[model samples]
Target: MTTETAGGPTGPAARPAPHRVVIVGGGVTGLVAARQILRDRPETTVTVLEASERLGGQVLAIDVDGVAVDVGAEAIHLGAPAAADLARALGLDATVIAARRGQSVLLTRRGLRPLPAGVGPTGPTRVGPVLRSGILSWHAIVRAGLEPLTRRRQAADVAVGDFVQGRFGREVTDTFVDPLLGNLHSGDIHRLSLQATAKQLVPVAESGTSLLLRALRKPTPPPRRPDEPAPLPMFASWPGGLGALVDALASSLEGHATVRTAVRVEAIGRTGDTWRVDTGEGPVEADAVVVAVGPRPAAVLLGPHSPATARALEAVDTASVATVVLAYEREAAEQNPVLRDANGLLLNSSQSGVLKAMTNMSRKWPLGHPSWHIVRVSVGRAGSRVAVDLSDAQMIAAASGELATLIGLNATPVFATVVRWPDAMPQLTVGHPGRMAAARAELAGIPGLHLAGSAADGLGLTSTIASGVQVARTLVG
Candidate 1:
């Protein structure tokens, strides 16, 4: 093999050879990284190795009643620019649509109550909404109101549950924070890292000001000018489904990179300046390598080369989840007109149910089927065996029963499918930032080696795609 310098050849007699890069794990992160590398350096040759037979790791779409529905990741945060920018770059701007602005209820013991306006994944952003929502008792409300007067400790890291409970009281933490933030990781809020999961709340928490007060003090953005275009929705996705994104990314990389599925990378070794990757089939060499696989698998591959990096990677944990899709005819949905008004519902941890959340797909997006209604029920969470131990039939039955009870639906769905994602979401528990920092620092010493994925950053379309792009730019430089 020949090596080329960054500046290319000094004379015409010697033309610089193309840089060869091999990416492990053909998930969205790996694919995005490959695309960035190819775009930035057209002379670079890229290869993507995936252990599974297909691509798009968690971003998957399945056919339900002749319409494409997303079983895995369904929406992208419009608050973040990475995903939107990438979508536009891929010529998917026209296909992008925002989530319908509809009321989403919370299943409390008292019955279904609207999720207090201004309450978010972290906690209650505005006090007026929480005060009027009646989700908390009068005494709990008083305690939450006194948050601004309370003293807060300045800690580098803390648990989300601990921080929120300390500031807003247990009632708020249990009713609002737990279901919203905890469900995001499919894990307990008490174990999730405050900095890693809810970084937006860090400044508010450490400022010693009441979180609710600060939220109220926040100024609203100015109204759009008459000449300005309409704003995008808070969440956006392709009409076909999120899978369209995966398909587009893969197609864009056709001649620029080679994507090989069903190819598992066993180990990674370094020989002098070049990196050697050993797959199930054979060994391959590359000028640079990007490891975008899950943390555990990445640890296994990097153990021999860097034990410290492996140890750090091992510290990151993951959670499994399953999404059950149910399609109902228009007649079945007509029995419950409320389904048409609301976008979805989230279950409180205190509620007795197998489902953590449910989304009314037909209302949230335009499925183009007026006679059909699609609903997605999510089951299982970190440390929960509801989905792991149950069979497909059991999962479907549980979801069906829950929907019937919640929506008063007696009719059966026209189609039902269960999609299980094992170890799909990474849990960024306390100390995760420090752990990742140490790992990245150690890996930096190894030239031409980079790590990028949800494990390195936080989980979400924005963070994952940004991680891939950042690593790709670093390699290109």
Candidate 2:
């Protein structure tokens, strides 16, 4: 174990020690950085300083009453190399569970209605099912069919909403794309960056190809082994929750991470070759420092060393959100396969109130003991009133009300927890990708410092892990 000196950094009266690393954050990025450093240079003393009393930062797990609630990053969007490799190396079992499937009940003007077959977040894949379904008017469907005839453009950047609207019309954007993709980003499609959001679809658009044809032509992989469960549509959890993953990474670092709970960083400055991280506790020295906090905090910490980076980061924007987990007996949730078997439902952004999405935990994982059904509800958006102004009680109430209305039940939740993330999910607005590339180039000259976390790339657990791994590789070398 890394021996952490809670006594603070070097003192003026004492002889300063050799070059040691002090990771500023204890989230997945910092933990992964510390782990990677140790693997490469086992002799270097490292310390991770965290302002929070607990680890995991946004990725947290809380026992609400008797059920565990994932306060942030409910699941991995895409299980890429970084997340998968780390889980295996840490001795954590990677079990796959199928994502939510089956009839999705939609709350519309006509009340709760089920989405017909062939239609998903992307779009309707089967013409027969879509034609037979009443989700869209014939006129709207005809407009959508004109996607193949839509004009293509080679612009550097365009709004996701504009692109989709230009091709499929407003009905598709508001009804299908907005609710599905918008809910995922906690953003509006009109303002989001196509390069950042629909990265894979860019080539198809450039080729003047058909979205339906591309969907149809996409290869489908074979089934998984009988012994190996199929991977979840998105990766998630730390086996014991995100906290466990943080703990595991922290354990490998020994004394490297200096967790300073409640000590807010005041500012950061450069002195000769060293970077001084000023905090309420004191100034900690580093060869170079990575401000892993969100844009606002990063701005506070960066000071004037890199004004452009700070400004860009500050302008990067973020959405505020809260996750509420409600538990119920198995019998109480009968008929809702999502609550009984699948991963849970991702609501369309068109839904009113503070709630946006929900996940069924017990249904998605292999539970050891039979227990009550666990469901997680995410609330608020980037600039929504629910994000900043609403109190925890208000947020919970709003979420619970929506739950009651949607599920046809209004009983008081046995366990409810609210998590307020001020700058939770970063909004990759139009030109965000270009801006990120520029920021990366500017920071490239700075040594022993690396920027990481969800804001730097995509969102979710897998991205976070990947960010950490990338930072690790940079710092280790």
Candidate 3:
């Protein structure tokens, strides 16, 4: 029953062996955790087991028209420091570049209309833009203008949809909030937790101040000093796409940790004070274990060890989304200035179609193929079943038809690729905080066990990385 320590062995004549840690899942969260642990405790043995043959879970890249394009996540919100800090630590700071263009329009029944200028991603900040954009009716505009003067009552938590609807009216919620937040989180705004999604605006809501007044009072930034460098872009990504980040993380773990692909972890249990992980290949014994898989898989693995934690995790729901990338002739896009000018387009929920959003990839980032134009179409949302049930061909057709209707481009694409992510995004409902707190409490009672990922925390890239680093630091300490 005796195990050798890190030094060498447990026998009187041998040195103690190092602590053993096993991480299930090779996605960004698990990879980051392995890297952090190895960096902090070099002598500790770390093993990362991924079911898939590749490392990154949702972050991936593919070739279209002889150019590498991001098929999964493509941007990181610079509002948070976690992603940027990790990039700097990994020596990827120089590779980071902001979006070449920031303008996005909404595809409505009337046609494409610019989203109100100066409007926050989730809602409108200024009334002038909303009025001038012509996206709202005159009545809706008047109601929205009165939002600042409206009285505000604060609650501990509220749904993003309900909060915006009550304060700003239904027009703003449906036209602005739904499409923007839906495209970002891949979930329904009515179910998305306000605190988890838009923590910045909560204070304004609670203060009962006029949103317009507050936004107008927002002071302009002081001029930068001559010696100061330019501020980082609001969003940034790697030149090779987000997949490069995954490759970088894996490369950094070389010589320090063991990484195994195509290894599925069936179950995890504790034996004495040590932990045992059952994989398809064999069983792994470790001093500690980190479960970085999705909530459903994590629930199954923890069910036998901790039913309460399992129940909490199983209660969490997820959404599925599919990305369809189409590469068209550059002439087709050039012929239509709208396609060339738009960085991205968000679909109004009221619009009749399967396509939820479209990103003009070529315009957003240089793909090194000037002769080709790449457009990425996102399908499905929190409550929609269109993407999960449809075949890849059908999805592509739907996307193509929608694109043609939105922009006048009917020529066949030179290349097309579909990436389906089933149950990849976690739905953070209003009561999510309580469930997460309970899960954490249950995990604290179990020794040598940790959980981290988009399911455990919020769905942003920053939150996911921060969760991994936080858990690894706790285990290392």
Clash count list over all predictions? 1, 14, 10
Q: On residues 1-477, what C-alpha lDDT tens digit does candidate 2 reach at each position?
A: 333232212112222234466667777776776666555555556666778777678777777654455677655544566776666566454433334454545554445555556655545666666567566777788898887777575563687778878877877676667766788778877888877777766775577677755655767867778986445344455454556566666665555445555666677777777877777888888775655666667666653665556656777778877777777666666455445444555566666577786766666654322546667787878778686788778877888787777766635666666667776778878877787787777677666555777666666666667777677557655
- Give the per-residue lDDT of model 3 (tens digit) for 1-477: 333333211122122358899999999999888987766666778999999999999888887756888888888776577776677667677678788865777865467876667766578776676667777887887887787667486763688888888888888888888888867888878888787677776786677666767777878879989986445677778787888778888888876689999999999978799999999899999999999999899999877877777777787788888999988898877676656787888876667487889988888887779688898999887778887999989988889888888777767777777899898888887877677778888888888898988888778677889888988887876
What residue runs in model 3 are displaced by over 4 Å at the alpha carbon? Answer: 1-18, 126-128, 205-210, 222-230
What alpha-carbon RMSD in Å does predicted model 2 have with respect to the real structure? 6.0
Model 2 quality (TM-score): 0.82
RMSD of 3: 5.2
- Name the 10 consecutive residues with the lowest summed lDDT in model 3: 6-15
Give the 10-residue window scoring lowest on summed lDDT in candidate 1: 6-15
Best first by lDDT, ranked: 1, 3, 2
Provide C-alpha RMSD values for all models, in order: 4.7, 6.0, 5.2
Candidate 2 structure lDDT: 0.66
lDDT of each: 0.81, 0.66, 0.80
Give lDDT: candidate 1, residue 258.
82
